[model samples]
Target: MLRNSKSGYGWIAITFHWTMALLIIGMLSLGLYMHQLPQTEPATFQLFQLHKSIGFVVLTLAVLRLFWRLINPSPRLPDGMPPLEKAAAHLGHAGLYALIFALPVTGWFMVSASPWGIPTILFNVLPVPHLHVPAALGSQEEAESFFKLLHEYGAYLLIALITVHVAAALKHHFISRDDTLNRMISAAPGKTDN
Candidate 1:
């Protein structure tokens, strides 16, 4: 059964939270490891392709999640939290939402600008067309360098934001022994009036 929180998050919100958490962790790992590979290796290109594909999937899921959040609502903070902590939590979540949107857009542009052409998926069977013409973007070297820097720096920012988020979650769950983590993880819904 769905438990109710003071702010009113239910099953849908919890489901989105946990699912995104897993996907984001996988993406962060992939992004970091791929960047470490030598640029000269064929495997580096393969990893980059995989990274783009995974990023597109994350973008789709994130859009759905954001739409769902807009239609529904998030749970309220625990009543006893300090104003500072509450403000921090709110800012942290906002930062997460912003990054979730930005990362995929940048990734898509990066791929689109590559001279080698970008691959696409339509359902499980059809391939879509690449959106950008490589000639229009620039020389191969320029396109590659520009998008690589965008992707790499964007990734670093995302990593920092996620690190702070994870730390905050841990602090809430373990140190504070609050329902912040439990609001998403517990099998039961919090105290719902209805």
Candidate 2:
């Protein structure tokens, strides 16, 4: 099925989940590598542009994914799941979605307020315009720095949440021996593992 069913995720949701996961991993790795580079180099500038382009792609996909989730509810959790675990799952997912949205917005705001005057050329084709910043922000540099901190911290928090998510998934698969992970991976709608 193309859409989510009560038994498990559909093709679209699985595609979105795995694709975003891969892109996020790449972006995070590239970001850490770029951070250590000498910023003044022409190559460093190119790297920053690449990072910004990927960030926009992530933001776009996140918007689509959120919209899809709104229309298609996720399958119910394992029958034996405890209330605490369910709460953690809900909060963890919310945190993930928040970071997925926040990181890009903050990065865009940071670039928009940057005094460096660099333009974001998406994939070397599309031109992305900066947001119109308010005058009350005082200096462009100050605004950029503030949003930069938000973006940076947001990335760290995202990494932590992903770690927890993966660990929980693995626990469900191995220790719990439930179909919790399998439903997202591949499972018939509403089927039980016996």
Candidate 3:
């Protein structure tokens, strides 16, 4: 059950999918909460550091997940699914992967461009190098603003995609009475017939 079959996902894929989903949700919530904290609050800096550490972890996992996906093809969609639905599923997955990658990179850039010049100490242990931004980009404030916008807006889009993804999975499971969601949720041994 460690390797994927045509009808269902393997343990590895299920683990990666659920783990990343939880981490992404946690990161989004943490980001929103941290933003609301007053700058002078003692917890604000700690929250930012934690957020950055988690973001780095997400980025690393995203890369590994992408590699795993390339090497191991996904389970086939339930039979009778429309071609358009299949295409949407593919594009939605691609967008999720793209956001997973882009969010961290943009966050790194935003921190690097920050006029405050705070060092990104991963987990308060290792220092992560910052992305180098050209000085010709007007000013540090301008660069930070640009990256901030990208990071914030990208998060909104990711949330929307996740919402749709969840709704579609639910629809497949309930309305369609398909095995789409169960395939990822369960790993019980069974024939490759859905």
- Tell me model 2's lDDT, rounded to 2 decimals: 0.89
User: In candidate 2, which residue ranges exceed 4 Å CA deviation?
Assistant: 187-194
- Candidate 2, 1-194: lDDT as tens digits: 88887768888998899899999989988988999999999999899999999999999999999999999968778878899989899999999999999989899999999999788999899999998877787799988888888988999999999999999999988999987788777645545633
lDDT winner, 2 or 3: 3
Model 3 steric clash pairs: none
The C-alpha TM-scores of every prediction are 0.81, 0.95, 0.95
lDDT of 1: 0.74
* Model number with the top lDDT: 3
Instruction: List the candidates ranked by lDDT, beginning with the highest.
Output: 3, 2, 1
- Tens-digit lDDT track for model 3 on 1-194? 88787777889989999999999999999998888889787789899999999999999999998988888867888769899999999899999999999999999999999999999999999999889987877699999999999999999999999999999999988999877888888877544465
Error of 2 at 143 (Å): 0.5
